[model samples]
Target: MSVSELEPGDREFERTPPHDIPAEQGVLGGMLLSQDAIAEVIEVLRTADFYRPAHQIIYDAVLDLYGRGDPADAVTIAGELTKRGEIARVGGAPYLHTLISSVPTAANAGYYARIVRERSVLRKLVETGTRIVQMGYNADGADADEILDRAQAEVFAIAEKRSGEDYVPLSEIMPGALDEIEAIGSRGGQMVGVPTGFADLDALTNGLHPGQMIVVAARPAMGKALGLSTLVPTPEGWTTMGALEVGDEVLDADGRPTRVVAATEVMHGRPCHEVEFSDGEIVVADALHQWRTSVAGVTAVRTTEEIAATLDEVHVIDGPDGRVTKIVDVRPVASVPVRCIQVDNTDHLYLVGRSRVPTHNSTLALDFARAASIRHGLTSAFFSLEMGRNEITMRLLSAEARVALHAMRSGTMQDEDWTRLARRMSEVAEAPLFIDDSPNMSMMEIRAKARRLKQQHDLRLVVIDYLQLMTSGKRVESRQVEVSEFSRSLKLLAKELQVPVIALSQLNRGPEQRTDKKPMVSDLRESGSIEQDADMVILLHREDAYEKESPRAGEADLIVAKHRNGPTATVTVAFQGHYSRFVDMAQ
Candidate 1:
């Protein structure tokens, strides 16, 4: 029969039964009058709500017998009940068989639980329907209100049972009664320091806490990827991870160049007597004999793409003479040329800065000014004035002015204007502000690389060149939803990593539509959640770039769109195109 056609009593009987009264007591006090008395007992047993205490006990007993591989037939059950003084005699065998046949088999433990859990609600609804029928309500005009009331009452009872104790006050408990400090101290102390460039940011964030995910997002051509690259660290005198040139020589274990050999040339039987893999695999090749041997299997792949595609597999390829060879697996073979440094070590300081401007101008000046302002502001705001007020002075010059300054006499006041600015900034700030110009990167790849760096070196801070060029790995009905999820993930990563992730984002097309072209928080493209998620959001606008200017062609306004902990204000900074930098205005 269909589930809906089954009577409530039949469904409930499959799950659980009601009380276990003695058979002697059943015959006393006119309880056992006729066949109707037996029918009444059967009906009560079948329709008992399993969620009630009495019903739950009987259900548990039935389930326990089933678990023990006992048949749940009425004769077996009646005998058990008689032994417990619950029944005086076994019921008619034919009637018992009918009940047993109707009982649903508990195919799985979860299925049995669901049946028992649903019995109470189903029985109550059936009773409400019966009552409405007796009250002269036509089947077609039955009031749903009574059924709903009964169902809600059962639900409320179940909810009440599940919702146990109220919350306890912390003040009432003894201090550290649970010994939380000792428990935490028992585990290895937390690792610290994935650095983002800001000191206050670092102080609040604790320098890129381990096991944390971070996103460096930026607009198209805003150096988001370049900013992430700067986080990777290399040994002193070695170029950082993302520098343009691959050094002429690969350093050996002893930090000396063994030789310069291309992978293709080596594979084509060009002699390499001493070829060492970064992971300690050795290759010995005799170019003259066109033969090669290695303790570890040596294989050669034609391209990096081939290697990447088979990265997860056991890659073996045919060598020049059709000899089976094992390929040396580079731990990190860059899919694209490393435009950003990957800092693996947490001990040394590293900075990640991203920009929203596609060109170098937006990132350079904002980064320089930000670094300078933070450094000088910390010194001036925190320490004594008498200790010699240290300030990071910067001059933003256009391409034409830079050319004119270069033409001036060496060491002259005019020549030193830009030089002095650079020098003063260097003196005030602990590290030089570097610029990144690379574009779009997938969020998964970005998180993977950031996590790797944090594991290797304990990264302190991560800055994105910008947020717009970031690819959210989501295919949604709306681009707005995709961007919203992406923004939320970035904030969650920052909080989870306990580091300040400063991402540069683009203003919406609405700004371009306006006459002034000034940006506000509303200009945050796609999602309003971006504004909500960010600890701070800054909008970079240069009025002179859009409108005609007289003298200060290099000035730009920085609007602090949203700041969680500080006042929102607009600051004017000088933007230089030539040096690819920004400077704080002399106040």
Candidate 2:
């Protein structure tokens, strides 16, 4: 009978789990022979990953020495073991010499480490299976669903352990953290993480850092949508959605020309709608298409569907001269092919149709993701809980190529835009920026995916667009509790991954109630834990967003309300709404 058919007490089932003693010896020997080998092997095989007890002790000693910037050869490793009174337990110094002699060459240390790690994983699988079998036997009256979930958790635990979630001594972390701080200081206070592309903000917060949860909160209508087939204004002239290409230049919400950095392929069979304005202008778009509107003096970006819900409310259209227009009617239209594009403007808006009506683009997370990958050459992962992957990609492209998002969404492009995209395409394409637009994900799922990305890509950054959309996976008493749980879990995730996590958040109506209309740390919706969990909190404020003709029309305030490691200050940044990005005010 095959192994699966064998009983629990069968001889085959009692056999030793998978392991390779020779491979473990080879790895230990290589590490002893060359200090460089230690660096390579350590990443693949942790101390517990070794099959033999002696090897585990040896591995730990070697790592301790290495972390302290000391030698890890036979003599040093033996001395380290001796200090812990474990020298004899690890077969003494002579065993170390024997290991060095056993290895032919240290050059294949990584290969040897892989062999050891593989066997360890197989051994873990066996252990996990045994535990699951026991659970099944003992789960007599327990809920079947609970037992199943417990079994699944047991299986997934292997992956979690392999992801380096084991507790580490403070000794191992302080060196790296201090070294990083010193390096930043050496650079005369240069940013230590992904650059925000805004100098003052970079100086204030030291960039969007790793293992951090950055909250960019604002009132509604701050950003995003567009469908295909909408006419868009361009420097070369107006163009149909189907005619637009990457690198095409188009006018932004400010009526300034910007390039299309990214454009999506035609999406067919989308539910379409026709929105009519008071000026007798009609634009055909999908329900997801966004429009800049003002209701009772509160200007915000609203989707076609949202606008349709309140037909009686006066909707003010986007205009440079502060002209207000009302929505006459919104009716469903025939399904049609739709396209989307993103530009490099900070305001992330562009004009559509002859009426010069303005529409929106998305967030700052894509900009940080793009900067981390293309500018800093670091791998980054963006978890877009709201937008789709295509839209996220287009936004990144827009930020990188200095193109306008609305222009690209409407498929309005000019030759200059294409040329600009061409210049940046190679960098953008090669960037280690991974986008996952999976919607309504739980924090547990995000952790699992982020762990995998961390292992495979050496992921350095994570950006989650808005936190409230995330679920706690299990049922909670209230939304606030769920959000609070997510907030705490996100902090743990950042620490576990050792990378910064930028989680976009929505502020409560507290900002709208204030005359200044500035958000505070207390405004983080649904949870007080969000304020406690975040290493930094950035409240995004634009005077022009509240006051139509303010003197600071194009300026944004990045209020660093809470900086765990540094001083909190408000950094003024230029809101290049047209280019879909933020720049230093001097720019």
Alpha carbon deviation, residue 363, candidate 1 (Å): 1.2
lDDT by residue (tens digit), candidate 1, 550-578? 15556766565665654666666676533
The TM-scores, one per candidate, come to: 0.34, 0.66
Q: Write the per-residue lDDT of candidate 2 for residues 1-587, one digit (tens) a residue.
A: 77778887796576988999899889989998898899898778777788889898888888888887998898888888988999999778899999999999998889999988888888888888888889889987876655665565555557655532457779767977898778878987556777866677777777776678777765433112345545565655457667878888886643457888888777778778766543334566788877878887798999989998998886767543333345667777678777777888875556565222311113555566766788888988888665667766776677778886555665666889889989998988998988887755767678778877877788899887767557645656977887887888789778867789887776665776677777799987778989999998888877766565468867778889999988999988776654567767775
Which stretch of 10 consecutive residues in model 2 shows the poorest summed lDDT? 353-362
**Candidate 1 whole-model C-alpha lDDT, 0 to 1:** 0.39
Residue 257 of model 2 has an lDDT of 73
Q: What CA root-mean-square deviation does each model show from the true structure?
A: 26.4, 11.9
